[model samples]
Target: MTQGLSTPRLAALASAPPRPAPPPGEAVERCELCAEPVRDGHRHLLDLEEGEPLCACGACAVLFDGQAAGGRHYRLVPDRRRELAGFHLDGPLWAGLGVPVDLAFFSVSGTGEVTARYPSPAGALHAAVHAASWRRLAEVNPVLAELRPDVEALVVHRARGAAEHWILPIDDCFRLTALLREHWTGFTGGEAVWRHIDAFFTELKRPGRPPRR
Candidate 1:
């Protein structure tokens, strides 16, 4: 006679944690609302119901600026980008959040759950984070309190071994995703990709805010 495994143990072994659906890649590239042709450099609006970043031409984007009226169905992603000066985070704090990568962006989704995503060759690789850990960090960095739900994120990078944080629009986060996907090579991202990444952050650090043209 052989002993059988317990039901709870068997059930636990059978189940695997679910992955967040990698957001729709290359969504329409053009304004989804008015069918206007959006340029490569364009703004985006969060399609609240669908939970996807919808491409929007300047005109259409302006319509939903701040908050979308009439039930808040859509919210325009702003152009704001600010480096979080003297942002604080240590190895233990970051590891406790449970993100597999050293560099990841944290944001809240439309339905109000925190999302931990990192740029990778595959895309923005989504991972589950410990909510309690995030709460602890938010207490230390009050700036986290200002993060806009869904359309904005707190992007942190320790790529060079020095932690850098930024409050950037969600669209910019996707741009980083696209950059990594296109230039990344096997295992470690190639030197070319690293240079590109450096340049991207350099531009972000450039003085003077981008004018609202």
Candidate 2:
């Protein structure tokens, strides 16, 4: 007798369509210094003490745009992406740098120390840059003298019998490192990783400034 009124309700409940899940809320990226939401292409600052990058809103980025703006603790990462024309790095010279990998980035630290890093599956592998070799390389490439310490890097691409050189923001170099860490596979890095690498280089060349000879 009690089930009489519930029969239709039970059938209706069973026949009702399942409700859809609510769409995920997009995560908003915020400036590390001011806690303000930043746009997709916001500026970045380098933490000199920790050698890490921090996203910044427009106003915060302008504050540290100068060399002495943040009291030497933070440096604004520039958006320059330059392809170096007539850049020279001979085979013997590359070998002297002591980086086992063909792809690597070289940067000068705040204290005038130069370090060479190459992306590996284990992360970025560091190599000692012989002082003499670096000096010779910099001597030929005068543009290197303009490289702002801790913000820019001399990125070399020599993999797959290709020789390409670019002066990119430190953030770009780190992005390449992350890309390789995510896609690299096996001893030869597989075909997929190479495709990504090619695409990355293409993007860099597309809007890049006229080659600095």
Candidate 3:
């Protein structure tokens, strides 16, 4: 006769960890709020209460398009991208921002706090910037005044004495941070990571499609 499996072993098996979800490209993404299937490039809503981005269906996203929409709980993140061709940022002003990396994104919170976030091998690291500096930058670049707080970001990239500036959606900044976090290797980030970085900027230079309703 065969012996029965022990109760402890059965209990342990019942508590086994769940399998990991499929990769981003392979997974079918659903809206976090309504569970509607969203396409790969779906719009996102920022959960102001939770301080995190939420995947949202087209209907849910439109409900929170305005700043005061959704009762202050969620804010629709815009999908605009504008290259600041004439923006000025000298070394001194850049240094005053206090970002340690060549690439960083700046955003103002609802509470008027200014922050600069740069990517590292571990993840995104945050740094504080003086309000005066931000104000000075905004004075020079009037377009910066148009950025919607908590939804848009000023992304800066300085490499080999070349400077590039763009007003991008907050999610775009998050995507860049995620890319660096995933591809970075060793102290210099290796050639493969740089190639990916180059590709990212190249794509950004192209035109963006209109937002989906």
- Report the number of the highest-TM-score candidate: 2
Per-residue CA lDDT of model 1 for 1-213, tens digit only, reads: 112212332233224243444355543346789987665457878766765567789988777775544146888887889789978788788888876666778888656678787755444467656678888888889999888888899988888674679999976776665566666686677788778777777778778643211
Tell me the tens digit of each residue's lDDT in model 2 across 52-160.
7788999999898898898778999997888899998998878877788889899998777788877565544665577788888888879888888989999998999
lDDT (C-alpha, whole model) for all candidates: 0.70, 0.76, 0.74
The digit string of per-residue lDDT tens for model 3 on 44-131 reads 9977776567888899988877888966688899977888998988888888787767888898888888878875654457877889
In model 1, what is the error at residue 165, expressed in angstroms?
A: 0.4
Ten contiguous residues minimizing lDDT sum, candidate 3: 1-10
Pull out the clashing pairs in model 2: none
RMSD of each: 11.5, 16.2, 11.6
The estimated TM-scores of all candidates read 0.75, 0.82, 0.81
lDDT of 3 at 41: 69
Q: List residue ranges in candidate 1 displaced over 4 A.
A: 1-30, 37-41, 68-72, 120-123, 208-213
Cα deviation of 6, candidate 1, in Å:
38
For model 2, the local distance difference test gives: 0.76
What 10-residue stretch in candidate 2 is worst by lDDT? 1-10
